[model samples]
Target: EYLHFNLFKENKDTFEANTIITRLLGLRTGASSVTFAGTKDKRGVTVQRACLRCVDHERLATVNQRLQGIRLGTFAYAKEPLRLGQLKGNRFTIIVRQIQPTAAAATLAGDALRAALQKRVIDEFAEKGFVNYFGMQRFGTRDIGTHQAGILMLAGQWQETINLIMAPKSGESATITAARAQWAEHHDAKAALAMGFSSLYGSAERALLQWYARHPELRHDPHAALFSALPRNLRTMYLHAYQSWIWNQIVSIRLDRYGPTARKGDLVLVDPAVDDVDDELVSAVDAASAAPKEDADAVPRVAVRALTAEEAAQTSMFDVVVPKPGWNVTYPDFLLPHYQSLMAQHQLDPLDMRRKWHECSLPGDYRHVLGRPRDVTVAFQRYTDPQRPLVPTDLDQITEAPTKFRAAPAPFQALPDVGPYDALILGFTLGTSQYATVALREIVEAD
Candidate 1:
C-alpha cells in the first residue's frame, strides 16, 4: 500500500526533507520508494503531499515522533505514489516586512506615502501579470550557477563538468572548500580520497573522488566515470537547469520586444492527440537503440502550435507557452531563430542533447510565459515586536519598582512595543510550476 500524508516542512528543501524522512523511517528501501509532488523553498514553511510505499500507520507514527521541524498528517492509502508536478497548485501566505516609502517621496507624504505605494504595487500586480523568469533558486545558490555546469555537460565536455563540480563556490562549507582546494592543487584522485570530508554536505564530491580512486585507469576520461557515479536525479537536474535558463532568456527577450501580450507566431497549446513529427523521430530512435523504456513516460512532450493573428489576440485569455528546448521538441516559427541563436551561442546543437550514454537526454516540454497569482489578496498591519524590550533606563535604581512589577503583573500585563514600520501580507495561489516568489519580486524588486 502507498501511504499519502500532508507534510509540513520548515527551513528545508524537498531533498533535505526526503533525507530526514528516510532517516526517521530507517527503511532499507531506495529513494524511489518515497515521492512528492513538487519541491518547496528551503527557507519557508510549506505544506505539501508526500507518499511512502508499503509503509504502515504504526511505523509512520514512530517515524513522526522522531521528526522535528516536519509534521506528517492526514494519512491515507492510494494505489499509486505521488509524482512530481502532479498537483493542481500551491497556496501561499507571505509577509513582506519593514516596508517604507522612498526617501524623496517620504519627505512629501510621510507615512501615508508608504501605504499608498504598497497599495499601488499590489493593485498593479493584480491587474497585470508578472514576467515568469525562473528565480535564482532554480539556478542554485552558488556563484557559478548550476546552469553553467549543465551547459558544459551538454557539450560533451565531461572533464570540465568534473572540474566545475570539484571547484569551490562561494558560501560552501569549510570542509568542501578545503577538499576542493586540495583537489585543485594536486589533481590526484588518491590524495583527494584520503583527505576526509568532515561534513555530510559534500556527498557528490566525495562520490566523484571515490570513483576516481577506484578507477585510476580511467583518469584520462574522468568525466564519464564521474558522471556515472553521481545520482540519476542530480545528473538529470543539470539538463533541466540548462533548459530553464534558456527559457528564462527567451522570455526576457520576448517581453522586451513585445510586452506581455501574445503575438502572431506565438505558441498555443494543441490537443495531445495531434501527431508530433519530432517526437515520433525520437521514439523511433529510442526503439531502434533499445533504450530503457521505464522512464519513457517521464520524458516531457511538446504539443503546441504557432498562433495566428486572431488567435494571438486571445492569448490574454489563453496561455502563452514557451518551449523548454529538447531533442524531441519543435520550436515556434517566430521564436525559432532566437532559440537557434541561443543554442549556437552555447556552441551546441539540438541533436547533441540525445546523449543516450548518460541517459540524460531531454524530452523538452512547455511552460507558460507569464504567471498570474490566483485568489490574490493584500493587507497592511503595524509591525510589532513580541520579544521583551531592553530593561528601562531607571530600572536598576528602582528595586522597589521591580518587586511591585513582579507582584502586580498577574492578568494586567503591558503589551510589547509596536514599531514604526508596517508589513504587507500577501496571500495567493499559483499553479504547480509557478513560483510565489516571482510574483513577490514583481512588487518589491526582491533580489
Candidate 2:
C-alpha cells in the first residue's frame, strides 16, 4: 500500500520538497517512489496530497520534524501511488499585497471605498470569468523562452538547442553564470564540466556538460544521448511549453475575433461526462522505445469535436476548447488560417509536427477557452506591517507546537480607518491546469 500524506510547504518548489523526503526515506530506494498530483508555485504557502511507496506512517511522520519549511501529516494508506493530474482541483488562499486605489477611487477614503471596490470586482468576476490564457510562468522568465528550445529541437538543430538550454540567466550564482557565459561564447563542454556545479539548480546543465565531455566528437545519436541525460518530464516539457505558447496567443485571438461567446466550428469535448480533462503526455523517448500496441482501451477517454452553427448557438463559453496543435488534433475551420499563419512565422508546418528525431514529434491536446473559479470568496483588510501573516496555513490549524508552523496569525479583519497598506485575502478553488494568477489578473486588471 502507498503511504499518503498531506504536504504543507512554504517557499519551496515541488521538486525541492520531494527531494528532501526522498533522502529521509532513503534515496537508494529511488526517487520515483515519491509522487504528487501537480506542481505548486515556489513563492507562497501551498498544501497538497502526496504519496510514497514502501514507507511507513511512523517514518513519514518523522519527516515533519526534520523539515523546516515543509511539514507532512494526515497520514494514511492507499491502494495506488499519486500520479500527475490526479487531483480534482486546488484551493488557494492568496494575499495580494500593496493593493493600490484606482484613479476613480482616489477621492473615497477608508472602509467605504474598500467596500465599493470589492463589490465591483466580485460582481464582475462572478459573471464574466477570466480568459484561460496560460500564465507567463509557463513560458518562463528568461531571455529565450523554453518554447524556443523546443522549436530548435523540432527543426533538428541539436547544438543550438543545447546552447539555448545552457544559456546564462539573471538569478543564478556568479560562478555558474560565468561558466554558462563561457560555454555560450566558446562552446567548450569540457571547460563547463571542469568549472564544477554543486548547486542542485545546475544538475541538468552538469549532466549535459558531462555527456558532451565524453563524446568530444558527435557522430551517432548525439541528440538522443544528450537529451537522455535529462529527466523524461523535463525533456517533454519543452514541446508542451511550445504548444502552450501557441494556445495562449490563439485564445487571445479567439477572444478578440469572436468575443467570449461560443461560435460555429469551435471545438468541444466528445464526452461531456469527463470534466477533469488533463494533458497526459508520454515522453517521446518512451513512445519511441515501446512497441506499438493495438489496445482499444488505450484511446483517449475525452476526444474533441467541432460544433455546427446550430449547436454553437446552444453552447456556452465553458464548453468551448482550443487545440494545442499536434498532428492528431483538429483545428477550428475559421481559426485554421490564423493558426497556419502563426506557424509559418516560426518556419513550422502546423499540420505536420513529426520530426526525424522521435522526441520532437508531438500529439496535441485541448484546453478550455475560459476558466471560472468555484466558491470564490474575497475580503479586504488594512495592515500596518507588510511582514505580518495574512492567512493561517493547514499546519497552523492542526498543531499547537511552538514551531514556525504555529506562528501564523489569523486573517486580519477589515478596519474602518485606513492603514499604511491595503491587502486583499482572496480564496478560490480552480480545476486541474487552471492558473490562480490568471484569475487574479481579471480582478486586478494587472499584467
Candidate 3:
C-alpha cells in the first residue's frame, strides 16, 4: 500500500424525507440519522455506527424485523465462507456525509413527479405481472425505490409553475420536489433488493419505460384540484367499486379515473355509492359546461367547482379489500426479508433509495466484500398498485374523448425462437447433448 496516495470514499449515502410539510423539516433536524456505538470483538474498544431509521415504523415489530434482516445481510454477513458470510465484517471505514435540505418553494414541483412515478410503476407492474391489480407480490419490488427515485430525478426543478402544477397523478405526485431529491428513494428500493428480494424487478423496469413514455408537456390537469379534494379510504372504495361496475359494464377498461378526453361528459351532484362515480363525473362535467353564465365573455373553465371539504374528505382511492391477499399471495415470500437478507450479506448497499432508480446496489458495494455472498447482484423487481397510469387532465380541456391515449405506441421487441422447429426428425438430436447446456442455464436461472 502506498502511504502518500490520495483516497476517496466510494460509497456515499444521501437521503431526503418524503412526508408532508412538518415531517420534512423534522428530518432536517436529524430525524433519520442516528449514531450507535457497540463494543468490538467483545473487547474494551468502542465503535461508531451511523444508521438510518424510520421513526414512524421503528417501533412496529414488522418494521424492526425488516430492518434487522437488512442489517444482517448488508453488514454482518456480506462476505466470506458463503453461508456464514451474511454480513460484511470489518471492511468499510464509516464516513457520513449528511445534509439537510429546505426548499418550501419546491413543494408543488415535488408532488407532480411523485404522482407520475406512482402511476407508471403501479400500472406497468400490474400489466406485466399478474392480472387484476395485483400488489407487492408481483415482480415490482426490486425497482420501486429506484423507479420512484428516478421519477423524482426526472422531475428535477420544473421549468415553470405550470410544469409543477401538471405533474402526474398518483401517490408519488407530491412525495418530493427537486429531481436531486431522488437518491434516497432509489437506494431504499435497491437496499431492499440487495437483502435478497428481487421479485419486484420486472415491475420496476416496466414502470421505468412507462414513465419514459410521457413527455414533460403532459404534466398538468385543470381538474386536479377537484380530484385532490376528493375523499379518502372506504368512501372512495365504495364509490370506486360502483364506478368500476358501471364503466366495465359499458366501456372496456375500468373508467374510475378516466379524464374528459377519454370520457367526454357532463357534471352532476350525486352520491358516489349510489350513482356510478364514472357516470356522476360525466354528468357533473356536462352540467357544469351547460350551466348558463352571467357574462358570455367569461372564460370557460377546464374543471368544475371543487368538492366541499366534507365531500373531499369522503373521497379516497384505496379499498378495504386491499392486502387481504388470498391463498398463494406472494406476501413476505419474494421481496422482503430474504431479498434484504441477501443484500446485507453481500454488502450490496444501494447509493440512494430516493434517486437514480435504475442503478442496482450502489457502485461501491459491488467491489468490497466482508462476508459470504449470495447469487444476486441486485434483487428482482416486482410490485403492483391498482391506482396506476393516471393522467392529469384540465377541467377546461374536457371536450369529450381522450386525445391522451392517441399518442404513438411504444416499440416492441420479440424474443428469439426457442424449441425444436421440426417434429421427431429434428427433435431427436435437439435434446441429445446439443441443447443440454442451454437447458441447464435456464433451469438454474428460472428458480
Best-matching candidate per lDDT: 2
Alpha-carbon local distance difference test for all models: 0.66, 0.71, 0.22
| Model 1 Cα shift for residue 410 (angstroms) | 20
lDDT by residue (407-443, candidate 3, tens digit) is: 2333333223222221100001111001122221221
**What's the true lDDT of residue 183 in model 1?**
84
State every prediction's TM-score relative to the real structure: 0.78, 0.84, 0.14
For residues 340-441, write the lDDT of model 2, one tens digit per residue. 999888888879876655556676767788877777787877778777666665666444334443344355443453568878888877777678788887
The lDDT-based order of candidates, best leading, equals 2, 1, 3
Lowest lDDT 10-mer window, candidate 3?
361-370
lDDT of 1: 0.66
Evaluation by lDDT, superior candidate among 1 and 2: 2
Checking candidate 2 for backbone clashes, the offending pairs are none
> lDDT score, residue 325, model 3?
13
Q: Give candidate 2 misplaced runs (Cα > 4 Å).
A: 23-25, 29-31, 61-68, 182-196, 201-203, 210-221, 277-298, 356-359, 394-420
Off by over 4 Å in 3: 1-57, 60-62, 66-232, 252-447
Candidate 2 lowest-lDDT run of ten: 277-286
RMSD of each: 9.2, 4.3, 30.0
